[model samples]
Target: MNSKKILGSILLSLAACIWGGMFVVVKIIVEEIHPIQLVFLRYLVAIVFLILFSIIKKEKWHWNTKDFRLIVWIGIIGNAVSIVAQETGTWLSSAQTGSVITSATPTFMVIFAWLILKEKLTRVKIISVVMATIGVMMIVGIHLTGKHVLEGVLSLVGAAFTWALMSVLVKKVKTYSSLQITIMSTCVAIICLLPFSLNNTTALLKINFFEPKIIFCLLYLGAISTALAFVMWNQGLTMVEASSSGLFFLLQPVIGTLLGWLLLNEDISIGFILGTLLILGSVWVSVKFAD
Candidate 1:
């Protein structure tokens, strides 16, 4: 209710909106660029921004051995693997399908937290898992009537599982500022993309860097979505409970679904709305009693 919490909430909401909007952006960008290149560029721009901020803020550059290990693991899983999975998944599935399946991340996170971090799973968590599963099924089952739907469904499930792993990994690392973490993770992603980036030299060279859409995506992804949003998220979590933070994440699918419909002319079926409600209920129950 205070200004800090209010600002955090707004920033978190904005982050969710950006994430939601990203699927549509990816769909558009892939028309002109390979997914790996696009994902690489997204992080490249973001890494530059984070580096600039670290310099401006005089954040310490020195990192301990333990911190280095944590960043390396986080970078590999969270940045490299998660992006690849999500991009590949979206390519295999519709944005709506990908978004809906992604809503199950909290469910995966709960299980991971319990096993890895010794967090107790209460009755609330159990109910949440069920609701979230049903919601996911409603969306996937309704939309997945095509022959290739199984492939899409598998891709989405893979993406969800990878992202869930990243979320748990984030909670485990205690060292490094969020900015440092972002920078390190992005650098790792850039390294991971080197082979693909090198192979696509002709295409990369032909790309008009000044293109309006590319510029827009770069700015939004780097400054607004990646750097500032990440900082705001870490700050918000400091002021709020973990369960409350997880609740806000439920906004991702809702905002993404609506934004895709409006901006990209992506279809929104009855099942999409119903599925969103189911996921929302799951998130609510998870957050309410996971304390």
Candidate 2:
């Protein structure tokens, strides 16, 4: 690969690592805070920090009407809606179920690209999707139970669709600087979540800033996960093909599942391991053979 591509890949890999740890952070924070309130605060902190960075860098905050609309759409689908759906799913379902089900993003990406980006639905793509779907089913097949399964499935479906839309939108907006686009979308997310944050003022204010968990989550969310990871992700999206970017995301579930087991002492089963392999294998096929 060229130097730019290699750099983008490394940055994206780093972003994925941070994101893998983020689930653990989110689970911890939600132990005390409501999902809505937690997400609201996370984005609120992210917005403040990003704005500060923008000011320090003397980055232009201005955008034309068209760019503003795209940024708003990105913020809505990628940040606001996707987070709500994922968190709601996590709240309702076991972490295993939520994690496995949400791995269905590539399926939605195929559909969305066909509709929006006019991307091809090749035989390899179809087979890859099937393999990934089957893999996820194998991984969480045991934990799929009760009405929570339905809730988890619904939340995951929403997450898949919304995130897929956001990816396509970002791909379309690749002309802009990744940093500018990241800041713009984060600003929009803050605006979208402002009312919720305002309503939860008492809880937010009462939150002890000195708590190690809270402090860690806030910094992790604001600086590493949201700002830096997104900058890397946008850069990757700009430099790489959409299909390739989509393929790299398959790393998320593998890394997340292993990390969950290690950090949270979550159980690992034969099914999960098998499913993970299948998913990874399918993604490999997609990346290697889907051309």
Candidate topping lDDT: 2
User: How well is each residue in 268-288 modelled by candidate 2, as lDDT tens digits?
Assistant: 766777887887787567656
Q: Candidate 1's error at 220, in angstroms?
A: 2.2
TM-score list, all predictions: 0.84, 0.87
Error of 2 at 24 (Å): 1.9
Error of 2 at 166 (Å): 0.7
What is the overall TM-score of model 1 with all chains considered together?
0.84
Predicted structure with the largest TM-score when compared to the true one: 2
Candidate 1 residues lying further than 4 Å off, grouped into runs, are 1-13, 132-142, 145-151, 233-247, 271-284
Span of 10 residues, lowest total lDDT, candidate 2: 240-249
**Model 1 worst lDDT run, 10 consecutive residues:** 238-247
Residue pairs of candidate 2 with colliding backbone atoms: none
Model 2 lDDT at residue 218: 81
